[model samples]
Target: MNICVFCSAADLDARYTTPAREFAELIGKGGHALVWGGSDTGLMKVMADGVETAGGRLVGVSVDFLAHKVRPGVDDMVITKDLAERKAELLARADAIVVMVGGTGTLDEATEILELKKHGLHTKPVVLLNTAGFYDGLKEQFQRMEDEGFLPLPLTELVFFAEDGAGALAYLEEQAGIQG
Candidate 1:
């Protein structure tokens, strides 16, 4: 199954990034083909590159705005128009969503995917790659949605957490039930 990995392009900064390489390698080794927004550097590229090196297929959905900005030597690229178009294209192609810790764009995209799940536009499972407790606040906000009577109990099951790459890949297999 195609797994959509949403992460920031800003993670190239050492101060802002975490050891998500473990996650990348785990997913790659698990044989889950990657479907992600195209960015040659940063955490996104880190994951894709690791996957490709590990003999995994990493499919990049490149938007017009980010195409020129993409890192050189990406294995596969499909260019689109803009951010919204890019996300749409990615979603169209993915069967699941794995959200890694990231900045505002990542958060916005995660929320948008959640919204799609809420509306039943897609029933694709979503997981959070929670490195070093980065997503505590966001999880709290999801809890608030339940407290405010907007969200439901099953949603807690919808977005599971994996502390590292291994856990993320394992949970992906558990959630998607696709070994290959």
Candidate 2:
């Protein structure tokens, strides 16, 4: 199954070190591939670089606005005029969503996947590699969704939690069946 590896563009932040490389290596060695925003730098690029080194298949999707800013040299470029188009393409091709710790950009990527699942546009499993509870606030929001009855308990199970890259890809393969 195709995996959309989502994360922040924060190259300067010290936090990008762990999740970036870990997620990339996970996707690469897990016998799966990567579909993510293309950038040559930052967490986004870090993951992509690992994917490349591991020789996994890669498909990078980025909006034109971000095209110049994206991680460079993506194997397959899925460029769009805007974010909406980029996201639509990503959703169309992805079978799973792996969210690494990121900033607002990463948050939006994960939330969009959640929304897609909510509306039944897709049922892809979304794995959030928390990496030191960076997503604690987002987890609370998901809880709020359950509390308000917007999401049922079992349905809430669609979102998987992991603390490191190894755990993330293992759960992804087990739950998503992405050996190919």
Candidate 3:
């Protein structure tokens, strides 16, 4: 599976990086490919490195402005004109999506992916890796939305909330019908 992971490009504490690395390693060791924002620094770097070291393929979708930061010698790299195009490319390349600890950029990516899925634009499974309880609030908000009838589909069908990397990958694997 080509798993697209949306995560921070900023340097993060070990609390966050540890799980991200573990998840990346799982993606790699499972013989899957990583489809992600191509940045060779910080958390993105951590994930790319772990996956690569574990023998997974790296497929990078980078914005033209950040092209310089794209990891060198990835299995595949595509430079888009802007963030929207980048997101589209990332989705187009992936069989599944994972949202890890990140800032607004990551949040934006996650929501947009969810929105697209809600509209039936795509049916790929999405997992929000809720490491360190980072996404507890968002999950609560989503629950409220479901309760209020703001969401057409059940909250569970929209996205899976996972507290650890293992759970996230397992869910994705099962959803994609890949025997792990």
Candidate 4:
């Protein structure tokens, strides 16, 4: 499966970085391909490195404007003209998505993917990795949205929550009907 991970571009503390790298390693070890932003910084770089070390295939998507800013050694990349195009490409190429601890950019990607699923645009499984309780507030907001009737309960069910990388991978495998 081609798994897309949305995570922070900023270098966070080891509390978050450690798990992110572990998650990436698990993705590679599980024989899953990775699709992500093409930057070699922060969690993105860690993820790519982990996958590379584990011998997993990688596909990076970057915007044309940031072509000069992308990592140098990416073998497979899809360059888009803009952010919108990049997002589309990411979603289009992913069989599943994992939402990790991140800042606003990560939130934006998560929301966009959720919205797309809510509208019946896609049925891909979306998992949120709640490492160190990083996504507590976001989960609350999602609940509030459902409480306010802004979104239906079933729509909110489209998003899955896991406490760690292993849990996320198990959920994906189950969803894909891949027997262990």
Of 2 and 4, the candidate ahead on lDDT is 4
Q: Positional deviation of 62 in candidate 1, in angstroms?
A: 1.8
Cα deviation of 154, candidate 3, in Å: 0.6
lDDT of 1 by residue, 35-152 (tens): 8887877888787777777767788898886778665665567899877988898899898898987899899889898888877788888888777788988888887887888874
Best-to-worst TM-score order: 3, 4, 1, 2
For candidate 1, the clash count comes to 2
Lowest lDDT 10-mer window, candidate 4? 149-158
The residue pairs in collision within model 2 are: 38-71, 39-70, 39-71, 40-71, 40-72
- Residue 146 of candidate 1: its Cα lDDT? 73
User: In candidate 4, which residue pairs clash?
Assistant: none
| Tens digit of per-residue lDDT, candidate 2, span 1-180 | 578887777664556576567667767776567888876667777777788787777888888877787665656887899887888898888888888877777778778888777777787778888887887777887778777887844444758777787787777677765453
Residue-by-residue lDDT tens digits, candidate 4, 1-180: 999999877888999889888988989999999899988888888888898788788899989987775777766898899888899999999999999988888889998999899988998999999999998888888888877888854644679889999899999999999975
Task: Name model 2 segments beyond 4 Å from true.
Answer: 12-15, 152-155, 178-180
In order, the Cα lDDT scores of the candidates are 0.78, 0.76, 0.95, 0.88
Could you tell me which 10 consecutive residues in candidate 1 have the lowest summed lDDT?
Answer: 11-20
What is candidate 3's TM-score against the reference? 0.99
Q: After superposition, how far is residue 136 of candidate 2 from its true place, in Å?
A: 1.5
Estimate the TM-score for candidate 1. Answer: 0.89
Question: lDDT score of model 4?
Answer: 0.88
| Tens-digit lDDT string for candidate 3 (18-134) | 988998999999999999999999999999999999999999999999999999999999999999999999999999999999999999999999999999999999999999999
